[model samples]
Target chain A: MILTVTLNTALDITYRVRSLRPHTSHRVSEVTERPGGKGVNVARVLAALGHEVTVTGFTGGATGRVVQERLASVPGVVDALVPITCATRRTIAVVDDRSGDTTQLNEPGPTVTPAEWSAFQEAYEALLPTASAVALCGSLPPGVPVGAYAGLVRTARSAGIPVLLDTSGEPLRRGVAARPDLIKPNTDELAELTGSHDPVRATQDARRRGAGAVVASLGREGLLAATRDGRWRATPPAPVHGNPTGAGDSAVAGLLSGLIEHLPWPDRLTRATALSAATVAAPVAGEFDQGAYEELLGQVVVSGEASAA
Target chain B: MILTVTLNTALDITYRVRSLRPHTSHRVSEVTERPGGKGVNVARVLAALGHEVTVTGFTGGATGRVVQERLASVPGVVDALVPITCATRRTIAVVDDRSGDTTQLNEPGPTVTPAEWSAFQEAYEALLPTASAVALCGSLPPGVPVGAYAGLVRTARSAGIPVLLDTSGEPLRRGVAARPDLIKPNTDELAELTGSHDPVRATQDARRRGAGAVVASLGREGLLAATRDGRWRATPPAPVHGNPTGAGDSAVAGLLSGLIEHLPWPDRLTRATALSAATVAAPVAGEFDQGAYEELLGQVVVSGEASAA
Candidate 1:
C-alpha cells in the first residue's frame, strides 16, 4: 500500500452560479463537495487505478468529519488522518455558468498545534514501514514548522521507501534539500523554485538541488522529467481540455504507481502524461476519464536524450 | 415565550477578502459562521431584548448540526428545529475588506420531505400554545407546500396567538390571505405584492388584501405603519451606516415584542424603527448595538393621523 501525507487538507466545495458579479447576490445552482489536498487527490486517482492507498493528515471539526465520511465511501483508500482541535478549512470554487470560469476562494487551513504535529509525525512514521512508496504533499498549516516536509521526506527515506514531494514555496525549497526521491512542481512552482521560465532548465536545476528526480507539469503541453536515467518530454496525443483542476495530482499518481511497478522513465512519463490529459477531460476534480486514459495511453509521445554519464 | 418559524434555515458563513475580483483566486482573510434565516435572526434579536424565543424549523445533516450547536450557545433562544433527511442550506457572504462591499452566494435550501414537513408543522404547533406572539419568516424550502406559512398563520390565529408574517413572493401572497395580525414587507416586497412603488399606497393596499395591518420597512427612511388604530410613519433619529443584512428581522423582532406588550401602533412602529436602525449599526447580522438601540429608541419620532371612524 502507498502512503500519502497532506498536512493541510481541505474540504473542497464547488458552487455553480449563472454569473459571478462583484457585490451582487448569486443563487448557486449546484453544490458539490469532496475531500481535497494534493495528497488526497493523488490517493483518489491511485485508488481508482486499483492501488491500495492510505491517507494521513489532520482531520478535525464538522468539516473534517464530513471529509472522513466521504473518504470512507471511496474504495481502496484508507483513512489515517490524525485528529486536531481546529476545524479543517474549505476551498470554494465558484464556477460561472455563462463564461465557464471559476473564481476560487480559499480559507486558511487549521493551525496544527505542536502536540498534534508530533502525533502526526509519529503516525506517519508508523505507516512508512508497510508502505511501498510515499508522497508528501501540500502546504504546511500554521504552527507546523516551514521545513516540516523536509523531516518527513527524511523519515520516509530512512525507512528505505521512495518518497515523492509535491508542494511549493519555502517548503519545497527546504524539502528538495532533504533529497526526496522525486519532486513534482507545476510550471509556476517550478519557475519560483529554479528561477527559470524554461521547463527543461528548471527541471534539471531542481534535480541538482538534491531531488533524486524532477517532473514539471506544464498545463496542456504535458510533463518534463529530469532524472538519473535520462531526460524526457512526454506529450499527449492532442490537447484534452475541460476542467484541469486535479490534472497535476493525476500526474503525480501516475508517476508514483509507475515507480512502485518499476516502469522505465519513458514509460512512467507516458502514463503520467496520459493520466493528466484524462483528468483534464473529467468533469469533477480528483477523477480521471478511464476511457480517455486508455485511448491516450498508447498515443503519448515521449522524446528525450539518453544520459551520457 | 415568542415562537419564530424559518422553513428554510441556513448556516450563514461570512468570508472577508482584501478585494473581490471575478474569475480569480482569493485568500479569505477572516471567517465567521452562525445560524441564520429570517426567523432565526428575529429570534436572536428578540432573545437579546430579554425575550425567551423558541425557534422551530427544519434542520438536517452536518450543517444543521453546526447551526444547532451555535444556537444552543445563545442565552434566551431555544432550538426546536425538526430533524430532516437532507442537509440545511448555506449562505456565503464574501465581504471585501477594501471597499466594504459584500458579495452573496446562497445555496438553495434543502428539499424537505413530506414527512419532514409534517414533523415541522407538528413541532411548530406544539410550541405555539406557550408563545406570546409568533413570527413566520423566510422563503419556503423546496418540497414544502407553497401555502405552508398560510396554514401555520391560520393555526396560530386559531390558538388566539397574534402572528406576524415576514416573507415575500407567493408565500407572502398566500400567507396574507390567512389574515396574519401583521405583515412586514420592505419596499421591494410591498411593490411586488401590491404592484405599487408608493409605500403609503402599497401599505394600504396590502391591508386590503387581508393583512390585518401592514408595515413597510423603508431603508434609511425608516418604518411606515398602516394599522387598525391609526396610520403612522416612524423615522429614526438619523441614518445609521452599516451592514443591513438582518435589519428587517430585527424590525420583526421589535414589532412582535411590542405587540405582545400591547403597545399602541405608533409606539410599536417606533420600537421597530429603532431596532431596525440599531441592527444596521451592528457589525454582525442577527445582532443589534444596544447603545444605538437605546439612544435611538427615545429619539425615534412617530407622527400620524388618528382613525376618524
Candidate 2:
C-alpha cells in the first residue's frame, strides 16, 4: 500500500455564477464540494488505478468533518488523518459560466499547534512501517517547521520505503537535502527551485541537490526525467486541452504505481504521460478518463538515451 | 417575545480578497461566518433591544451546527430550529478590498422533505403560543409550497398573534392574501407585488390586497406606511449611507417591538425609520449603532394626516 500525506487539506468548494462582477450580488446556480490537496488527489488517482492507499492529514472543525465524510465515499483509500483544533481550510473556486473563467479563493490551512505537530509526527512514524512507498505532498501548514518534510523523508528512508517529495519554495529546498527518491516539480516550481529557465539543466541541478530522481512536468510540453538509473523524455500522443489543475497529481500516481509494479523506466514514463493527459481531459481534477488512458497508453512516445539502449 | 421564522436560513460567509478579477486566483486574507437570514437578522436586532426572541427554521449538516453554535452566543435569543435531512445552505459575500465592492454567491437552501416540512410546522405552532408577535421572513426553500408563509400567517392570526410577512415575489403575493398584521416590502418587491413603482400608491394597493398594514421601504427616501389606523411617511433627519443589506430586517424588528409596546402608528413609524438608518451606519447587517439610533430616533419626522395630531 502507498501512503500519501497532505499536511494542509481543504474542503474544496466550487460555486457557479452567471458572471462575476466585482461589486454585484449573484445567486450561485450550483455548489459542489470535495476533499482536496495534492496528496489527496494523488491518493484518489492511485485508488482509481486499483492501488490500496492510506491518506494521512490534519483535519479539524466542521469543514474537516465534511472532508472526512467525503473521503469515506472513495473506495480503496484509507483515512488515517490526525485531528487538530483549528478547522480545515476551504478553497472556493467561483466559476463564471459566461466567461468560462474561474476565480479562486484559498484560505490558509489550520494553524498546527506544537502538540498537534508532535501528534502528526508520531502518527507518520506509525504509518511508515507498513508502507511500500510514501509520498509527502502539499504545503506545510502554519506552526509546522520548514524542515518538517525533511524529517519525514528521513524516517521513510530509514524504514526502507521509497519516498517522493512534491512541494515548492523553501520546503522543497530543505526537503531536497534529505534526499527523497523522487521529486516532481512542474515548470514554474522547477524554475523557482533551480532558478533556471532551461528544463534539462534544472532537472540535473535538482538531482545533484539530493533528489535520487527528478521528474519535471513541462505542462503541455510533457514530462522530463533525470534519474541515476536512466533518463527519459515522454510526450503525449496529442496536445491535451482541458483543466490542468490535478494533472501533476495523476502523474505522481502513475509513477508510484509503475514503480511498485517494477515497470521499466520507459514504460513508467509512458503510463505517467498518458495518465496526466487523461486527467486533463476528465471534467474534474483527480479523476482520469479511463477510455482516454487506455488509448493513449500505447501512443505516448518515451525517447531517451536509456530507453534507446 | 418575538418569533422570527427563517425557513431558508443560511451560514453567511464573507471572504476578503485584495481584488477580484475574472479567471484569476486570490488568497483570501480573511474569512468570517455568522448565522444569517432575514428572520435571523431580525431576531438578533430584537435580542439586542432586550426582547426575548425565539428563532425557528430548518438547520442541518455541519454548517447548520455552526449556525446553531453562533446563535447561542447572542443573548436573549433562543434557537428552536427544525432539523432537515439535507445540509443548510451557505451565502458567500466576496469583498474586493481594492474596489470596496462585494460579490455575492448564494447557494440554494436545503430541499425540505415532506416529513421535515411537517416537523417545522409543528415547531412553529408550538412556539406561536409564547410569541407576542411572529415574523415570517426570507424565501421558502425548494419543495415548500409558495403558500407556505400564507399558512404560517393564518396560524399566527388564529393564535391571536400579530404576524409580519417580509418576503418577495410569488410568496409575497400569496402571503399578503392571509391578511398579515404587517408586510414590509422594499421598492423592487413592492413594485413586483402591486405593479406600481410609486411607494404611496403601492403601499395602499398592497393594503387593499389583504395586508392589514403595508410598509414600503423606499431606500434613502425612508419608509412609507399605509396602516388601518392611518397613513404616515417617516424619514431619517438626513440620508444615511453604508451597507443597506439588513436595514429592512432591522426595520421589521423595530415594527414588531413597537407593536408589542402598543405604540401608536406614528411612533412605530419613527422607531422603524430610525432603526433602519442606524442599521445602515453599522458595519455589519442586523447590528445598529446605539448612538446613531438614539440621535435618529428623536430626529425622525413622521408626516401624514395622522401625524398632525
The segments of candidate 2 whose C-alpha lies over 4 angstroms from its true place after superposition are A307-309, B307-309
Q: Itemize residue pairs with steric clashes in candidate 1.
A: none
Error (Å) of candidate 1 at residue B39 is 0.5
- Could you estimate the TM-score for every candidate? 0.98, 0.98
- Give per-residue CA lDDT, model 1, range B101-168, as digits (tens): 99999998999989888888888878988999999999999999999989999999999999999999
Tell me the whole-model lDDT of each prediction, alpha carbons only.
Answer: 0.93, 0.92
Q: Which DockQ values do the candidates obtain, in the order shown?
A: 0.91, 0.84
lDDT of 1 at A212: 99
Give the worst 10-residue stretch by lDDT in candidate 1 chain A.
A278-287
- Per-residue CA lDDT of candidate 1, range A8-62, in tens? 9999999999999999999999999999998999999999999999999999998
Q: Give the fraction of reference interface contacts each candidate recovers.
A: 0.89, 0.88
Angstrom error at residue B134, model 2: 0.2
> RMSDs, each prediction?
1.2, 1.5
